[model samples]
Each structure stands twice: as structure tokens, then as C-alpha cells.
Target: MNLSRPLLLASNSPRRKELLASLGLTFEVRVKEVSEDFPDTLKREEVAEFLASHKADAYKEDLQEEALITADTIVCLDDKILNKPASAEEAYAMLRALSGQTHEVITGVCVLMKEGKTVFHDSTTVYFKELTDAEINYYIQHYKPFDKAGAYGIQEWIGMIGIEKIEGTYFNVVGLPVQKLYENLVQLKIVV
Candidate 1:
């Protein structure tokens, strides 16, 4: 849990917090309200990183000596972004769209310090088996994945049953790409 500097995770996501803690570095949870909007001109692959950096900037003025970590996760299918669902019907539709389809889960991360900043992203391609309407409803009713991107949590029951395979790290699909983030923190001498 020793770190070169105080670490601040600028996210309210429980999954990200858990992932960061799994790295064995103690960090403080610091949440700030920031706009998640991105330009329409940005490609699907670029939005996650863009929003991550944007969130990082919002916390820059508050940075003293602490290293701030910010991240944004998005689910993309056929060049469309599936944001957090607002209603059960929307969640159902998203899960339906993802049934038997391959989709990209991209997480953009930013490590910011008063000295400098590093912005990067990790992409994982997730393959879902065809899900039955009953299965989808069951998951929605039981898990209530409205807070997750793509209306699904890879660590949840639906993921256990629906996910067939993934090309990249499973942790990336969970939320934070801890391997990459740990490396970045080490390279920056933020963590021992």
C-alpha cells in the first residue's frame, strides 16, 4: 500500500475502485461532477479517452502532490455507443442488441499530476452468446445492471452465462485495465 505520492481515484465506480485496490496500492476515492459529453465528430474508439482526459482536467486545479487517476468506460457496437441505460426497457434493448454479437469495451484512463499527465486506453472485444428474452429479463430483474455500460456487468451472472469469449483482458471488460494502469503508475514512480 505504499505509494510515492498520495493516490486519488477520481471515480465513483465500485468496480474501478475494486480493480485499483487489487493492484495493492492504497488510494483515496475522490469524486467530482464533470461533464461526460464529447464532440459528435469523435470516433467511437476515441470517446472513452477523450472523456477520461476531460475528467482529469476538471480535477487539475485541485491537484497538490497527489496523483489523480480518472477513467471512462464505454461499450461500442457497430460504431454506436451504448451508454448507461436510464430505464429497464433501454437496458433490455441494449442487451438484446448485444446478444450473439461481438462488441468493443473500451476504457480510457488518465493519470494526472502537477508535473504532467498520461492519458491512455484499453480495448477489449467481448463476444456474447445469443441470449433468450427470458434470460435477459431474469438478469435485469435480479442484477439490475442499469448502472453498467452495455447494460451488463462482465462479473455478474449474465456475464457468466452470456459471455462466450473475449480477446483482451477480462479485467478491462470489468471496468479498469489494472495491468496497464499498474504499469503506468510504476513508470511514473507513483507507486512502489
Candidate 2:
């Protein structure tokens, strides 16, 4: 483990903060504003990684002696990407569309060290039970999922009752995939 370099996490997501904290790694948050908009030509699976790399690029100059971690998570249904909902109606629509469907939650992570950079992605298949309009409305109004991709949080009230099953790392759906991040760090000799 390298103690001389500090680890900087560049994201505004509290879920990402909490998920990274769970790994017992010490880090500092350095939020950067990058335009999340990407080319429409990108397949649904590429968007997350592309945006994550974009975020990492923003911190490239600042990490000469630090490890910079940047991440992006997106929800994909039928190959279409669902990002954060902008309005209540949009949130309801996203939730309604996800009702009774299995969607892919893809999280892209980038770890930039002094001499190298690693970018990877993880996908989780989440199955949602059939939800009623009342349920969708309730979650949109109560949970206020405007900040979450797919308009819902798997760790919140909606996921507690609506998610029936999952096929990959549950923490990926939360935000940063901590296990993969830790393994990558170890592989790169950035952490023990």
C-alpha cells in the first residue's frame, strides 16, 4: 500500500460516498463538474464507462501524486439508458417503465494512479416486481428519486419492496462497485 499518495474521489453522489466508505479505505472527495452528456451513438453499455473516463480526465492534472477515483452509474432497460430523472413525471415514467421488468445497472469506475490508469465496468441485473401506479407515485413523491439513476434506489424503500432478485454485485447498483475497485487497487499495488 502506498501511503504517500492520497485517494481522491470525484463524484457528488452520496451513495458513492457511502459505498466507498464501506471498503475501509480513506479518501477525500473532490467533486468535479463534467458534462455528463455523451454521444447518442454509444451503445447503452458504453455510456457509463465513457462518462466515468471523462470525469477521470478532469482530474488528471491534479493527481500527479494521488489516486483519483471517478465513477458513473446508469440504468439500462431494453438497451436504452435511463439516467437521473429531471422531474416527478419523468421519475414516475421511469419507474412505471421499470415495473415488472429486469433492467441492467451498469457502473463504470476509473482509478488513476501516478503512472497508470485503470477503467472498468460492472453490470447488475435487477428484477422489479410489477408495481402499481400508486406504488410508483408513492415512491416518486416520498422517496424523491430525482437524484438516482432509473429513478429509484435499490437500498431505499422502493427497492426493499420492489426488487425481487439481482444477478450481480448489489453494490454496483448502489454506485461504486467497491469489491472490484478494491481488487483493482490491490492489483495495481495502490492499496493492500
Candidate 3:
């Protein structure tokens, strides 16, 4: 499919870039520093969507005529949001909370066309088997998942041995929900 305008991904996440590439779409990356702060009163899913849109808004002036994509993923467990871990101890704690439990991974995506706008979100429920302290410690020390949400990556060692099941898109847990984003792009007339 030949598109009139090029595609721009306004994110620095390698996972999102890989996911987008899997769809066979050629794109360019432009990273911008945007504040992710949101109102604490916003609900979990709302927070994700808001932040994703906020990132997209940062590139409005630089969008030109190309379609821009921005997204944010959050791990929510028991009403708390688990983002990137600040320290090894935090990573261990986040993993412990997810062990032998089901948590929701919601990814909010914003697809901004030159003249059209579309925003949507996808969520996946991940279930982790009980994790021993040794397993958690080993993964933390070996992998250092400080850049991943919930202190883990679905495509990493911890996920291979810890996640027992998932009720939604597996890619969403990694970062971006490609299937959902593709559909939304078509709906917004960004791609056909």
C-alpha cells in the first residue's frame, strides 16, 4: 500500500517500534521529552489514555502531513499503577505483587493524522504463576528490567517462566497493541 504521507512514531520505545514494524509499515522515529504527569484522581485506564494523547500533542506542530503515533502502557494491579521501576528493590516488590495474581496491562494509543484524529486503547489481563523470592531476585539482578512496566517484560526471562496465562493481546503487555492500532489507523483513514 502506497501512502501519500510518511508515518512518524513519536516515541523512544524500542518495543513500540518493533511492534509497528511487524505490520509492514515504514516509519521514522522522532523522540521528544514530554512530561507524563497526570492528575492523581484519574482512574488507571484514563491515566494511560491521557498520557498517550499528551505525548501525541507534543508533536502537533512537527507532524507536517504524516501520520503520527504515540502510546503509553501501564500495569495496574489492585488499583495501583506500576510503571518503570526506580530501583532493584522496587522491581522486586512489583514482581512480588504480580506473582500468582492476575493484573491488567492497558495500552493507550493515539493516532494523529494530518487532518484527522483517533484515540483508542487496548487492555490485556496477564496471570503470573507463583514466583519464589530467589527467582525474582535472580531475574532482577540478571535482566535489570528497570525500563519495563510491572518490572517485567512479557518477552523476557521472567515472563517465560512466570506468566502462566493471558486473557488479551500479548503484544499489549510488551508495549504496543499492534492489532488494535492497525485497526484504528484504518478507521481513521491513515492507512488503507
Write down the TM-score of every candidate.
0.98, 0.96, 0.96
Candidate 3 residue-wise lDDT, 53-167, digit = tens: 9999888887778998899999999899998999999999999999999999999988887676678889999999999999999999999999988899999999999999999
Best TM-score goes to which candidate? 1
User: What are the root-mean-square deviations of the candidates from the true structure over C-alphas?
Assistant: 0.8, 1.3, 1.1
lDDT of 1 by residue, 47-148 (tens): 999999999999899999999999999999988999999999999999999999999999999999999999999999999999999999999999999889
The best candidate in terms of lDDT: 1
Note the residue pairs that clash in candidate 3: none
Cα lDDT, all candidates: 0.94, 0.89, 0.89
Model 2 lDDT, residue 192, Cα:
56
Model 2, TM vs. native = 0.96
lDDT of 2 by residue, 16-121 (tens): 8888777777889998679999999997668888999888998777777889999999999997889899999999989989999999999999988768789999
Question: Residue 26 in candidate 2 has what lDDT?
Answer: 84
Whole-structure CA lDDT of model 3: 0.89
Candidates 1 and 3: which is better by lDDT? 1
**Model 2 collision count:** 0
lDDT of 2: 0.89
